[model samples]
Target: MASFPPNRATTLKAAFRACDVGPLVGADIERYYVDLSNVRNTEAIESLNTRLDFLEPAEFCSILFTGHRGCGKSTELRKIQKRWEVEYKVIYIEADAEIDILDAEYTDLYLVIIKKVADELNKLNLKFDAQLLHNFETWFKEITQETEQTVERSVSISASAEAGGQIPFISKLLGKIQAQIKGADKQKQTIRQLLQKDIGRLQADINLLLGDAFVKLKQKYPEYEKGFLIIFDNLDRVPPNVANHLFFDYSEQLQSLHCTIVLTAPISVVYSEKNLSNAFDTPNIVPMVNIYKLERQRGDLEYNDVGIKAVASLIEQRVDIDAVFESPQDLLELVKASGGHVRQLMRITAKAFLTAATRKHNKVTTDDVTYAIKQEQFNFERSIPTELYSELAKVCLTKDVPKDENGWLMLFSLWVFEYNGKTRWNYINPTVRQSDAFQEALQSITANP
Candidate 1:
């Protein structure tokens, strides 16, 4: 709905080339970033930055960063890494990239964190003190009955004899154990149980390593004024059971680490029975970019012109909407249907582009948009049970999500979207309301009422 820059793509091929359904990373951040902090009403990463960088006594605490899966949480975290690289030796741990997320346990995370910190520092030629390394390695050996020889048998690290130091042996040992955890091998559970037997010792050892690493880094690297910052991304992909085990059951253990840690969580965690306030500070939530205007009456939400324009800018930054769509209104239609979800908008736009090409259209038409949205609506309809349709209609009417399991499931599934105003509220996904099941359900409820 808003005019875009002139240097955008002109051909359908160019439009297709511009589509990226994943989060922006690397150089793309500088190219395609749209600042929706004003619209989402939360400066998710900046708040953490303020706490760590600006606060008087240097607040070092475990942070909970959460949002819907594709609402640009990773992109924001990358922004933090890039923004504070000089001040913090940031170690970003991507759970999916590094671990078996579905079955991950707290012990597995402990292994992953220590291994990564060691590996990262080793790359900088900054090793933990040799005595500390020997102490930790000897403890691991006795606890798990795992010696350096047995560890090398599982993972193919070179002979430790050539690496003449305790740090290399310690690094190799951690690598082997973490590999066992990541590979889900026979030793995985054993390692977990052994670690859990003395989990406090494990925590103590890690904090010792962190403390030494902090001192070593601060001493060697004067530019690193804030020490180490470890961010755990995509931890949200873990199932609810595992999330509860990590965040609720073992929260204090997680917080006990003497470093600034940010853990991404599923958006549903906020509504869980266990209050996050009991464990960590208030979670820094990156809410959906509100496509609707502020101060609207309940159940009568209208699109905000500025919000719509911002959503369009997200697309325009990637593809030339003028080149892709037959009319500006066609782009607007997709934007409204996106419910301000970044990945959803890209999905719809890409699908419409492909559908247009198949239909022999030079540019994306309203017909293509309708087909894409209907396809998405069909997906949401199938995933939702018939019984929930009435409940979804009620959420649409009241702009509130129930704080029980059902509501958490709905938000997790994207059947409902959370938006920020004076307070947060829920509404049905824009395309979901287009389905016949939902329409019928809403009409039935209205008529009966």
Candidate 2:
């Protein structure tokens, strides 16, 4: 029997650790590797292909893509962008890049929109028309001045010499000015009306800029026939209040815009009662692709088996697993325990390979997998707060928690565990269900007075 050289296994394990989760592993590994890409699912690819076909002409459609974080929503979006780039002018921006917009006053929202549009246009290597650029600058200046006046009228302060001396000139002047402006109710009302007027003008300028871009593209490429598409991801990452205003209050303005806007927002933002007024209803307006449906299908053997095969293949690329495992079953068990979460399985298997390699083991048995599982569990627990464990326990024992009014929302949050590049809320982790630690905690809770 061929044996791995002394420390050669350790070196191999370390090398595997450095490999990025992105990119294709070898062909054999590609078959078994849990693909976080949408290409992994036939259904998803077909659905997206159909959506792309519909959007090819680009008639101002608003789409909302929602999924559990890391369930490959972003990856799918990028794939669509890549596929559509040939036909449509595609521009992608992440909403979280503008974190300052969380506390954005109404005018600040318009500024963010303009900035994103300008950035995307620049990225596409498109030159802005000098006429439109001048109009945007004039509109932006007016909006900024109007916003400053509104802020001055909303906040009041009693300026003191001691505090004034320490404050920046801008802050001090704004503070004293705000105090004077806010003292009169009529002035405050006037400021609000002026701000609203400026916002309307800003919106008009943005519409004009988009119209100009579209017309210029059509004129430049008379033979080329596709509209521009701007995709915004991580809109949900914005503050809830701002997200509500952007989607709800400005829905009509967004819908009227010449370009197709695709937004990836959190499901909660669309569903929240406080934010629901005139917001696009969850089912009706936005085209949503459900990602969870791809994990399991009709009476098929749980895809967990396929997931295991995939991870094993990926591991083979970096580790000489033949010498470590007597049979593939041992490796499969490790994958099973990982609950199909690709990242977790890779991390656990990598750690176990390192552990076994250091021990000079030629065959990693079930014991090695067992050790790795425990190590992974410990790592997971350390990262999560103890409160989460308690909440999870509540979920596991009852299988159903109280809904509506008073309930532990976090329990519902954990219902879906992201595993093996899929989101699974229905499948329970068998190891977790059977573990003594988990059971003991449940028993202790049950027995308590």
Candidate 3:
């Protein structure tokens, strides 16, 4: 029932424009955040809040948080940042945006974390030991001789633009290195390969800087008692191979950095062959917001009123539902089709708006909603291999996701929705369930069973 900002009376085109599909960030996030803790089973955010609140200021820990790509993991992480901002100097980094995410290594992550913490400390007018940073800069310079010309040019330009001391200078140099690491694959590989042999020295130098930075920051800002809390977000966007390498193979390196950290991992890692808990703590999973009635034995899916209203409120916060939708029923149908994925709901609603606008309808109608749903169905149908349809049906019939590649694939593709109840359950996506492939598979299972 709460109103969102940038709210106004508008034309159909403006209403369509208001329907943004990207993950909410910066100032816009404040307007659209909805609390789903009561409706969904996952307690990732709450558990994180409690743990971080109680953690010692200088103690280091790593926590893995993951979920489906568009299922609001970023939004939830941002919420955690806000809640802990008073106690921690949170350095929230979007890993993919900063690094070549698919090819990122543990060494690259260490450099990124060091650079970010230094950047944040500089903002607070805090400085680390000059000799420590000089040693690090010299070591990097020795290895980066091949790219000296380019690195010099970048640092020179940045230094001229922003005048500062040693910490700022190192920050600028690391900024250039970070840029090269992200921009050129060859450069990234060179940096990683060079650092591979000297990882101990690299980590040792960074830790020296971290120690100094932490001391200075704690001394300067008494309120920031917890020091730095680095959140490496969107590491979840990496492919499975890359995820396994980063979160599984090099998990110790990922955790060894001398600060509390939260990394977003791919959900598949939970079911990976690796014993993730052995390397890091048990991962915090953000499951889909359950929007269906519970059935102990799998059968036909039905809607849950509370879950339906929770998803519906996400849209109501952004646009005037009554003005855009022909009726509440039409809105409900669109929400049901989303299967509790936040971005999918917005994508479907955006499509419905486009369909209505294209048809010259004053507002969205049932036909518009159906057309939107069908378009999404086609999208899922194309991505999902025909061979997997039966597997999806098995999930729908048995209320269980197979612990095989096919099940993980369904989950990754969002063709199957995972939710927690008395235990975890998987169901065919509402729209995907309506596809001919799923219907036929369901019928085949029913007839045979």
lDDT of each: 0.81, 0.50, 0.81
Write one digit per residue (lDDT tens) for candidate 1, span 276-353: 778788888888889886443456478988889988888887776666788999899999999999889878887888
Choose 1 or 2, whichever is better by TM-score: 1
Identify the runs in model 2 with alpha carbons over 4 angstroms from their true place: 1-45, 56-58, 95-125, 145-198, 221-224, 234-257, 267-278, 281-327, 347-391, 397-415, 418-449
Off by over 4 Å in 3: 1-5, 8-11, 25-30, 146-150, 155-167
Tell me the TM-score of each prediction against the true structure.
Answer: 0.91, 0.60, 0.92
Model 2 score (lDDT): 0.50
Report residue 427 deviation for candidate 3 (angstroms). Answer: 1.7
Q: Candidate 2 lDDT, tens digit per residue, 235-335?
A: 64555456566666666655555577666654334344554434543311211112123323321124444445654554565555666566678777766
lDDT of 3: 0.81
In the predicted model 2, the residue pairs found to clash are 32-310, 33-310, 324-364, 340-419, 340-420, 341-419, 341-420, 342-420
- Model 1: weakest 10-residue lDDT segment is 1-10
Relative to the true structure, candidate 1 reaches a TM of 0.91
